[model samples]
Target chain A: MLLKIPLAWLQLARQKIRFIVALAGIAFVVILMFMQLGFQDALYESATQVHQKLKGDLFIISSQYKSLTSQQSFPRSRLYQVLGFEGVESVSPLYVQFSKFKNPQNGEKNPIYVLGIDPAFPAFDIPEVTQNLDVLKFPNRVLFDQASRPEFGPVVENFHHNEPVSVEIFPYNGTVGYQVNVGGLFTLGPSFGVDGNLIVNYATILRIFQDRTPEKIDIGLVTLQPGTDVKRMQAALTEILPNDVKVFTRRDYINFEKDYWSVRTPIGFVFSLMVFMGFVVGVVVVYQILYSNISNHLMEYATLKAMGFKNKYLLDVVFQQALLLAVLGYIPGLIISYGLYDVASNATQLPVIMSPNKLLAVLISATLMCFTSGFFSIGKLRSADPADIF
Target chain B: MNEKTIVHIKNLNHYFGGKSLRSQVLSDINLEIKAGEVIIMTGPSGSGKSTLLTLIGGLRSVQEGSLKVLGWELYGASDEKLVQVRRHIGFIFQSHNLLEFLTARQNVQMALELHNEPDRIAKVKAEEMLHAVKLGNRINYYPSDLSGGQKQRVAIARALVSQPKLVLADEPTAALDSKSGRDVVDLMQQLAKEQGCAILMVTHDNRILDVADRTIYMEDGRLFKEVVL
Candidate 1:
């Protein structure tokens, strides 16, 4: 039976236009589900890129901080408190702020995220940023995000041509508040909130924002010695630090960002809801198709029933039809979604890579969706009575 | 149960709908059909002729009395039991319900699928059966491409391909013209004799009464008279 195609396939394929229409409808729902799931995945992936790249075993952030996208500053003294603990290897402070960038082309100020770190070691694992760490030691020099939206001017093109491209920053609210030199290009892309990124030295943070005090910092990246348990270090920091700051390991911090977006943000909830709606749409469309198909062939089915074919045989045929539609429709849906993912990633500058887990999940979801429809349409098959065929 | 008897029935009753609004469709039907016997049940429309045929064919459950086919009692029988009983009986419908999606040969081949024969053997048997009905050249034509008489021949081929002991036909030639109808019944008579299967057919076509070994008349759901032609 597995090797031979069932008569259901022949019956469905006999009507070319109707079969194509059904396939198109199923594929439409599949694509809807893929895009929604893709956007939700992209939201989590891009939002947690910084946490994944940061070199740290533990992190300290302000208790009021909801996510990395909305960073708040805590007193720098809290970072020193963790250093007093035994087995604490090193602690480095990271400064973050949503500063405005003066697009050198048209002199328009657009919001760009800025990261300020000490010049001693790499704060991020990005290759371009790590290789060009020496230049950050010079004041007013910053690394430009090459994947930034085009509104940030041609800093990438200018740097490749060996031209000196300069960018002005508006730290709080002033025209040309600080002039930062774009010495090199890096790629951090963007998150759901902020577009474009600029990396600078800790000293440049104070120079750009003169009103800020040096006693506070946005994040404290902490490391532990070899073979030290991270849980013990986390417990020690929690007991020693004040209520104004919170401590988390690298994994927890990444998960916190994901949770904040997935549960707390409306866009995340909307994407998830859209995926569910796509499932509903698929079930409805497929149920109508299978039900109508059964209706059209009611007499034939009754005749089969009259010939001693059991309910299982009829069900197998409908289920086989569902499986075929799931596989066939899913292929085109996934192909189209791949194109949409590229277009969306380029348009939003978010890291929207299609992971294997997401693809497998959608495939399983498609199968289940069609299966549910098949089950629902079996009620119509009940109407096929051998008694009525007489 | 007699070994030579293919179908035996006594005081059979049938109903329609739930108990509160029940209506009797067949009442106290008593019939016995033997091997290679051709019994034509002639009656007006709504005289329970089709209902009785379906009951004997196990298309419907017996509400009362004893009905046995192939030595298996059908009173309070499970659906599984009824399905097994149906395997030994072939049915021909009024509309010649050949699946339009299948060719004439495939339509006949569908009967052999249930017998668990090899695919090649089923094809061979199906082609042989279609050729027996003089449809050799139209073996690959779908029912929609077939004419009225051609479709009925294909239906007959499908029903007899399995060599069922009892063939129950419900107005098998109702949709054909006079000449085609006569030709269809004559063909059925010839095939039933060759296969040695008892046939219980319900029809109002008086032109083909001579084909039956005996003819019974029904009025208002009762077997009123019997005549041997």
Candidate 2:
């Protein structure tokens, strides 16, 4: 029934300026960790936006396929082969290429990703694209991504107001521009490599790029009958498909694209390294604060020892202070990170969101970081002899 | 040793520094104190008076010879044994060493807290002890707000709150004026008599020497003379 005093809290509260400065230092590193983790996740999310939105159970890509941003094409005949499987329902050939999009208002051109599919079949699960498939059937008509960067002109705003927005599209290295009408709008946001997206008919891609052949395609989407085993079909397809193409389940397809950016690219490596550096910096900051605080109160601690209190009791006090700092410092850091997510997302047109998992992840990391510091700084208190201090 | 002897020491020795630079701080020290006895130890600086007090209070491990407090031998004692001995003894230093963040009542309660007394009982005992020291009105004041004499009184309340068997004080009034110094020792003597506990005070102040039942003087790490009042 003995009432234990919160010695850790009282010690920290006694020095208002020092406590505030310590919290500020911890918050700075927490903010650094949150932002690095945020952007790293956003990179994977944005890069796989199209892959996640595709309405298919299985997919086929060229064996040389590295990522969606890369232009890897295989023979269209490989896509037609998927239809012969027993669980197969239908297959659609998707042509993806980076093309120049000329802003009609300013006549400036920027690189845009173009996904060309047959208008007869649903190539994407997006409501805007599925609902407006008939519009793409018309020659020189394409659906522009509503989430595309503002640099793609005011296509969505003008189109929503019943005004026609026409922009010219050209092959990556072509000189002449092909006039295309912005038929509708969808929500595939930009990635690091491509700033805008366009959904067009398969024949339009061939017409726009004269060098493109009918037999070549970038990706092949395969839908299965209900209750069909996708894994079985994927295995059977991989067994029969020529070595020029690779088969993948939709889940693996998305992960494959994510792995390309997270493992094979320098941006992902840099973000991870930055997060580790933030952790090290946080440990150092907390260590310095706790070390100096213990040093200042060495006499009181020795007095406690002389009063028959065990070293365990004093250690408990120090660890309690560490936990307090972790939780208190994490709150402000999370709030600021939320604000920054909005700013970064709006500015870059990428998906930078705060998930519950990320929040929990950072909390655990902050607690661990502080505990590491607390463990290191207690050596002085442990060796403090009441005899010497008196 | 008599059953009433609270602290008994014989041929005790202590040293400082590592093996290469070892220096003896106390040698051939012999002392004894009975229950309810007030003993004063005075000597020139560096005469090892404080060192002997520290050894008797279990602040430092006994390096050689037999030292016993409340019937527990301390020579080559384990840390746990030293800690056990320490809990039964009260220590008062020259400085009050009050936790600045805590009030006077809480600081006094820290001693009783070591015995795991219930919060309500500890509070009652701490307040009663403070009242005995005539600081009832300032129980809620922090150490920083108290005067030097008042701080020393608070330290007295803290050391005696548990009614420990032996009280060890090292230069308890070194920073106080003559009047306050006399008042502090008088307060300690009154409280120790009331609790029937022995007091071993190490001091250089001669004004308060009359309060001790016997005075012991030391020079060159040896107990040279004993004067019974």
Candidate 3:
């Protein structure tokens, strides 16, 4: 017997109001889910900016550092010690400090992180910042994100509370501070959360922060030479470094960072809950709409049954209708979600990266919702007897 | 008398509800419809005429005795088999039962399509059936746009398009006026004789009894008597 899927679709298409309502309900849920997915990704990108760009073969940090973005600091001496180990090609010392920069336009001071790096190093740690070094070479100049410039002006004073916003370096043995000058701004996408970042040369940082010990630094990025076994190098370095230090390969660290944020933060949970709610809402609304439509057309369905349509054929009609509504509605919902993401990103200063992975996840979730909603009505479809019409 | 019987019911019994409040709808009923016969089942309301029709059409379960349509025994048949039996037996309801969404032509074509006939052939057959019912000018009109008599004609056309071995119609002309009702019954009898298909129609209108090849009177869930005119 021929299935009536096409006939069911045609029937749905004829009822313009019902068709539109069902489609819009599914689309609304899909858009809600996509937005939540974007927000979760944005949070992760903001928290792991340095980790993503460093792309190091290995990360050597103090064992006391629970997370890559944690406040733990280590000694600069570890870099030289790591370099002495066989198979180690290069080591870069990185300093991280937070300070406030005054906005020339609004006179408002925005909190910012200043990343100190050595230009002559291999620059493997942060190619994005190091490749654009000309902007950093200008005196009192620093690179700021284009997205952050609206709040903080192109130039600003370094003074806070009648004193230069400078702090003493622990290991470099020098005072480190500088007047702020905005250099070229670039897009870092939605993954980096820093509103304003200051990139400066290692020498400039050391000159400003005085009385810092040369052996102590905040973090170190390590690269292995060609054909060098990273595991062997890590083992060799472990012997010389103090018990307080730790070593991790690139893949291990990325997984560790992702796991850390996903487990330790409420952001992941909140987004997951939003996604779950989106599914529940989608199913409920679509189910209610379909159930009502079916109930309204109960007699009609009985008539079809009387005409010798198998229950399976009747169910195929319902599933086909649901599938069509989901796919048709998802298109507009995806477009609306992207537009909303842009507006929300600018308004909240949060990165809403709409990556392929995130989009795929949202689409799958939406289709699953439609399937579930359509599935919920199978029992009713089977029990609808043609004899009941009399 | 030797003609093949398209439908045969023997001691058929049906009951509604359970032990505490059981009610019999059909009891000890025996009916036989032969090829090329136009049979009318007449009774007052609640006399089980429609119930007997439903039983023979495979729309209701046969609770007690044997019921067979087109040589397929319904009591022992699976639901799938019952549906198969129904495909060869066209049915018309009092309410017309035409899909409101489909045009008159499309409505009639639905049965043919369900039988897996090619679309081109199904459409041509549907159009021819509608034309025979004198609905040629209203092919594209939805049920909502058709008059009562026109809608009934469309329903009749749909029933006949499948070229069924048997046709079961319940109160087919009850909702139409005298002239339209006569036209519908006359057309149904003529089509039954022309196609050599057995037709069993349930109605209370005694005025159309002259068109029936055989008439069976039902009362209190059993065949009360028979009339040959």
Using TM-score as the measure, which candidate wins? 1
TM-score of candidate 3 chain A against the true chain A: 0.82
Q: What tens digits encode model 2's per-residue C-alpha lDDT throughout B7-59?
A: 98999888889899998888898999999999999999998888888788788
Query: By TM-score, highest first, what's the ranking?
Result: 1, 2, 3
Tens-digit per-residue lDDT, A195-279, candidate 2: 9899999898999999999799999999999999989888999999999999999789989988898899999899989999999
Candidate 1 residue runs with Cα over 4 Å from true position: A1-5, B17-20
Top DockQ hit: 1
Candidate 3 on A88-162: residue-level lDDT in tens? 888888766655655555655665666676666634345546666775665555555544545665333332123
> Model 3, residue B137: displacement in angstroms?
0.6
Write the number of the candidate with greater DockQ, choosing between 2 and 3. 2
Candidate 3 displacement at residue A250 in angstroms: 2.7
- Candidate 1 lDDT over A1-390, as tens digits, reads 231325778878888888888889888988898788888888888888889889889999999999887878999999888888889899999998888998888988889998998989798988888899998999899998888888887778888999888888997576556888898888888878878888999889888888777788999999889889999889888888899998999888999999899889898889988999999999998888789889888998898888887778888999988989888889988899899889988888877777798789899999999999999999999889998878
C-alpha local distance difference test of each model: 0.87, 0.90, 0.76
DockQ of each: 0.61, 0.59, 0.54
lDDT for B218 in candidate 2 is 91
Cα-based lDDT at residue A294, candidate 3 = 72
